[model samples]
Target: MTNPPEKTPENPWGPQNSSPEQPFGQQPVQGQPAADPYGQPQYGQPQQPAADPYGQPQYGQPQQPAADPYGQPQYGQPAAQDPNAMANPYAQQGNGQPGYGQMAYGPTPALTSWIKRVGSHLIDWAPITIINRITDPMIGGYDYASKTERVGTNPTLGFILLVVGFAWFIWNMVFKDGKTGVSLGRQVLGIQLVNADTGQPVGAGKAFLRQIAHILDTISCLIGYLFPLWDSRRQTFADKICNTLVIDTK
Candidate 1:
């Protein structure tokens, strides 16, 4: 019946053979450049610069070599490469809290300071505790009053005691090793002088420096001793300048 009205071929083979469901000449989504070489999208607006690990840029992207806008470490350099970077970014170091190092918190109160002060009035008792046998003969034999009293007797006795005590103070401070390396008063209080860096006994050279500074400490009649109450490190001005600490031995 008229060659079945010019039938199409049973095989699919031409542009006319294509399915109308999909359009021609379009790329599959997998082939399009949806991401940059570093796996970030080239956003619609102008792309801001970014750094790559190897300090080079992917094609079509600007190179940011040195630093980021945030100013942290860039591409391949260590943050600590500069020595200043290792310094504490915060200013509150050694503030009696846990610092980065192993320096523990400083000495705490054993007894109330007034108790120590009252007890200090009787500190002449301590030399007896140091040695069971008397090193000085007069300490053991209590012959109560000498012929010369300070009030009614020889002025020479007072002068001799003053001169000898001052001389002994100078001599001992110039050559000793311990907390009281600087003073008998500090020693009787169960303290020891130590270096700021090493926290161990310092030498005579440093002690001399402290002794010179003691002029300032003594000029005001030991008003300087009250400094540790207000100072952040619990140090007097002399202790600060001499780079020392007075630690408790008790």
Candidate 2:
């Protein structure tokens, strides 16, 4: 009999087949990952986080604030004003005049006294009053007149004077005063009629409207004309309605 083959132990799992390239005793199963001995990441897997070499902020670290995108003023800096902003109508002025709004020219003039205003009005109406007195006999007289005395002796002359007076009032009060900010009476009294807000003349149309507004004074028992005595702005109802002022030009 040939020398008996040396006795050898058989692998319990499978037949032993080892190679120099595969240091382990057997090859890994197909489609299964190989075990790593040094805990290194395998191919196709995500990498672990590493230290920042450039000293930049990393995830979960504090960061510096960014610059303002709008270039707004920083802390302790004065804020800039908007050029298109509207002016305040009620703003007080340094010279003690209450502001009506923005005026392109300058500060408003001082207000005239009630006495001066009244005197100026009287001066303006003097011519009409005298003409009315002179023409009284040409128009219908009072009911108390004797029957022998005829009323309205010359209606033509009375009508003529009436037209003249009305024309005179319109020319002086509306046209002249509106254009120049003064009538003959206002000029003599050192007063002026002007827009309260602008310190400028009110045009002829507005002056005519102001005369119509005076009807309020008449209907209110003439108390509107006297409003200047107690009113803070020294304005009559007509003046208030027209946004006008009687100011001292002197």
Candidate 3:
């Protein structure tokens, strides 16, 4: 068979000159991307810099740039700030002398001498006094629980009352749904007992301790319990011995 004919060059860009034989006057490795003077992607596109929503510039640290002669923001910067206003929006400040130690000065309450607080509902459990003919059905004074009747009643009735009273107080101060002091009664009465210093609710533990200390209040035939009769805040001896206070939870 005859060999195929050899191709002849046609133009100056052909192999007849120094140019290599390739399609369309191209060179080898033609797929590489073009580089710029600085060797970055270019075409009127710019390198992006981050910015805050208000177009303010931010850095790792707060800016303390030189101020203008008129004490305003530099020509291209944001608005100036007032020193008397809030410097940091999140920083906490208060109305007090600027120092590490802040002192609260005011008149202490005049009634500080009386610390014990009790619910008015305790009156419900107390022996009620009868004056008129006694009519109310829920707590009619004609019953044995009436104060006048209970006061001069037979010794047996008084003994039973003493038992009931102790039980009532004991149940009130401790052992009620992990809380102390006639829970529902006090809740309905809009009162609560708390530690004086911590301002926390009185719990079963403290209630138990307080109940055990009632012996001191009963020292003089429980005459001290009635001492609140003469005192201003009406706190009994047991209340003072314990560092507790009753407050209007409502």
Q: Which number leads on TM-score?
A: 2
Candidate 1 ranges with C-alpha deviation above 4 Å: 1-160, 177-184, 218-223
Local accuracy by lDDT, each model: 0.56, 0.85, 0.53
| Candidate 2, lDDT over the whole model | 0.85
Q: Write the per-residue lDDT of candidate 3 for residues 90-155, one digit (tens) a residue.
A: 443575434343333444223322222333434434432231113133232334554453223244
Q: Candidate 2, residues 139-186: lDDT per residue as tens digits?
A: 756655565555798989998998899999999999999999898889
Number of colliding residue pairs in model 3: 1
> Alpha-carbon error at 45 in model 2, in Å?
51
State the lDDT of candidate 1 residue by residue for 1-250, as single tens digits: 5655677767343243334343444333543454455756555657665666777777886755755666578657776455555666444566646555555556652322433432442453244343323222323334357743233244455455445655554456656643334345545676566777776677877787876786776687876666766666666677888887766667
Please report the TM-score between candidate 2 and the true structure: 0.56
TM-score, structure 3 vs. true = 0.33
Question: What's the lDDT for residue 74 in model 3?
Answer: 71
Q: Arrange candidates by lDDT, highest first: which order?
A: 2, 1, 3
Off by over 4 Å in 2: 1-107, 141-150
TM-score, candidate 1, is 0.35
Worst 10 residues of 3 by lDDT: 128-137
